[model samples]
Target: MVGGYVRKSKAKGSSNVSYSVTCATCDEVNILSHREVGGLTLPLLHSSHLYRVHDVHRTSITATLLSHMFSQSQGRAVKQQLRFYSSANMSVNLEGNIFVTGTNRGIGLELVKQLAEKTGKEAHIYACCREPEGTSAEALRGLATQYPGKITIIRLDMSDEDSILTAVQAVSEQIQTAGLNLLINNAAINKPDSLAQLSATGKKDMMEVYETNVAGPFLLAKLFHTLLQTAAEGHTSEGDKMSCRRAAIINISTIISSIEKCPETFAQAKMYPYRTSKAALNMLTRCQAEDFKIQNILVTAIHPGWVRTDMGGEQAPLITQDSVHGMLNVISSLSNKDSGMLLDWQGEKIPW
Candidate 1:
């Protein structure tokens, strides 16, 4: 199903009439032309087209059409009027405050970089990392400089609760009453451990991984809960007709976290610590999704795919740019229905 409306084109030419229809289901935007409807009025044509193509119809199509006709008859210009409905692409509101953790390198750095490029001044992105002066962190700092006020580099050590609180406070002061719109829990650590090597040393390594990958995100979400709730309230106040308008938390989990798809041979490869921590992180995502439903915050776990990072090494199938790009697309398309699901970079649901 799709809904469409006609608006006066702001383009230089008066004859330029642009009509946009977005699918109510997928939210994919389709730019329509008069040629496509062969002179039929846009509303009537679109109503019939949606019914025939998507089997979806809105009862207000007639009212909308009459209203548009009335405006034309009155010799008044119709400004852009929008009716909100849930759609995959429509869920992404880029003009909001977004925070990304572990922005020094790899996927985190790429995500910050791409987001800055995509949203420009429309978004305020807080890029957080442990060491602000490190080489990779310097690169992120350069991006912040390039984008100026759009990006702020905050010091955040995922293992340190005080550091996390400081970062949250910094974001709060910057965004003020606007609140935090999205939190990307991208900070994580991976340590390889085998069952055969299960000893005190291996246990310590596993605990460290758990602290960074699971506990850190859990605590960050807890500390930022109020900001997220405030953002949700602001979204609702906008009177967007969308069924759900919630702030979002994206946990950067991995496909390796899936216990259901784990093969015996792969499971014994001495990567137990990394796998177990991500699995725990996935569980945390599910718990947060259920717990935050009351506040209308959408929490999701996503696998960014095996990309060519320091962790993924040379033979990795995807590159950081491609992986981050896909992940952003998936993130932009998220609805409340997707909360708590373990999804891939491409937005496909993954096994538990």
Candidate 2:
């Protein structure tokens, strides 16, 4: 807003008329000379405020140049104004089209509370739960009351393929009219059942945790890629100009997956299967990030700080809100630079 641009165009001979215009976004000025200028209507060259950060700024420069040609015919040339806003200058609305898996309890529950209760944005929360309609926890009921249209309780059992398929179909239908922008894969199980416990995890239970914790979110992202793309397209179509941003995927992971930083001592330390599963999830985060780079989808794992929950128990170090608040801040700070990272609640990069 502090500065604007000026542009000028000129015709060579006595029969030609000259034109001048200025852009406020960038100080760079352009001058054009046309020999035979007539009743040709051209687009007005707007300043490249948003395009400055993109790799393809040339496209914008060309468009601006073409617009300048069109502006000469009209006596009053048009100036497409641009105003720059940074994270420091403007408050970022951290809520929008969101899809959160495993939102019935713990971090997932807290995420819904913060996004809907605190931020109060137009959030479409897909609260994926085993028993979505009737959870034992009354806090969720309170949440539903507080945020009516913002929350949609979807019955998604991560382990059940049939349930996942059904949920996917419903999601596809819901997003056809609108679209999903944010997806949080927060539903995970950390029960302390070891390899030796009950002879190979009953095949049902083995796949159950993996299906929900890992495979379900993986499949969901794959399923919603097109929806995300369309939503991003809509965003660009609106505003002064299009943005390069896309949908985001946040995977709730544990520091126990960190080979070097894993806790040395825990009361229930013999859960080999759970530990291995989370480690695999960490790898999955990296895989998704690497694969979806072009889609502009940032996939990252977060170690929600130790909290007092059903899984963390009463003796945990942090409370639910404290851990979730920090994680939310970290999420709010996410940019293109921080994609494909394994970070903690404090936004510090966690060890692999």
- The candidate that wins on lDDT is 1
lDDT of 1 by residue, 13-102 (tens): 566554444444455544545453233342221112111111134312211233344336322434332323223222234658898999
Once model 1 is optimally superposed onto the true structure by TM-score, how far is the C-alpha of residue 15 displaced, in angstroms?
A: 62
lDDT of 2 at 231: 64
Tell me which residue pairs clash in candidate 2.
Answer: 4-24, 5-22, 5-23, 5-24, 6-22, 7-21, 42-70, 43-67
Candidate 2 RMSD computed on C-alpha atoms after optimal superposition onto the true structure:
20.6
- Tell me how many clashing residue pairs each candidate has: 0, 8
Q: Specify the poorest-scoring 10-residue window by lDDT in model 1.
A: 45-54
- Which regions of candidate 2 fall more than 4 Å away from where they truly are? 1-92, 135-137, 192-206, 237-246, 263-268
